[model samples]
Target: MAMSLWNPTKRNSVVLGLLSPRAMLTRWPSQWIGGALADSFEACVDVQRTALRDAGPAAFDVLIGSSWGGAVAAALIAEGAWTGPAVMLCPALSELRRHGAIEAIVDQIAALPAERKAQCLIVHGDADETIP
Candidate 1:
């Protein structure tokens, strides 16, 4: 998986972009949490953990996730895997539930400590049918 680093300001920032399963089918310049598609949700998280270990969690400044990837990003923070800021765009929590993915992660996200929860920003559109 490719992780991009850019100097948006005086300080250099590393942005990890996690693409959704559908997005993976496209030619978008993003990657799954793991370099390859995972067979289970836990496998996905494991790859992210490995990435953090290899790259150092502190190396990342922000996490940006789209659709199912958003759910993964939220899980990382909720499970204390990542302690940095994240931007989740239309996380596919409902779709995950439908596909038999872990449901408790959602609760875990809601129950996150205020300070940690504040580090995440979720963007959802009211008219979005896929993730509504």
Candidate 2:
């Protein structure tokens, strides 16, 4: 089972993931969250578009992220890119100036063809400084 941590196979069962910066670093969760949770799960660390495209067809049971990753997860879902349950921790939902235009999350969500926002639960702390 230990060898399966680095391997993405059917045997890994549910794929629980952490977002960028820590996405590719799977071992850290096992150490920090305790061994029990890591015992039977395959940690998918790479969630970037290029990586996802290169990986071919893959199914995710749920998407969980913090900070920038949280914002990414929300954007991906609102854009109808990823269809799955998600949990965003302190997601950055505001707009940013990119390429001389303001990119807002509200517009992204509104753009969904059939209102296909992925089922997501957001947990944000008022005192959080990373996204503030």
Candidate 3:
């Protein structure tokens, strides 16, 4: 989970931040962007099933994810686990092949409700060296 608080005093909004694999290892982009966003920033090393589910509905207002994190965000939304909107930057959906379960993930994404799919925003950079 990645989140930055624009105002620590104001807990009305929470934005989940998903970090890239590289960012997770180095804590650069994650820390830099997350730190600059707001004071309520939180980073999740990994999006585990129990943890994400336990976070409940009020845990985040929106999700912003990069690379692998974006894939997790997409999976969560596709599985009907998350209802809020999402912003995926260079989502590594293609990397699912490495898990030997890309089909399962695709099926899950395909099963998403129309309304749920409508709330997501996916941005893939042509020059993205990581996912590309």
The candidate maximizing lDDT is: 1
Of the pair 1 and 2, which is ahead by TM-score?
1
**Stronger candidate by TM-score (1 vs 3):** 1
Best by TM-score: 1
Q: Give the per-residue lDDT of model 1 (tens digit) for 1-132.
A: 232233223121122213334436643444333322223345566667788779986788999888867877877877888888899999877766664464678888888889888888999999998788
lDDT for residue 114 in candidate 3, whole number 0-100: 85
Q: Where's the lowest-lDDT run of ten residues in candidate 2?
A: 36-45
- Can you tell me which runs of candidate 2 are displaced by over 4 Å? 1-47, 56-58, 95-102, 110-118
Please give the distance, in angstroms, between residue 100's alpha carbon in candidate 3 and its true position after superposition: 2.4
lDDT of 2 by residue, 60-123 (tens): 5777877556666665665555666779888655422221112555577667655354367789
- Write down the worst ten-residue block by lDDT for model 3: 36-45
Candidate 1: list runs displaced more than 4 Å: 1-38
The TM-score obtained by model 2 is 0.48
lDDT of 3 by residue, 1-132 (tens): 433233333332123222323335655653644433222221222343457578887887888778766776766666566678899888767754443324565688777778877888999978877687
Model 2, residue 43: what's the lDDT?
26
Clashes of each: 0, 1, 7
The local distance difference test score of model 3 is: 0.57
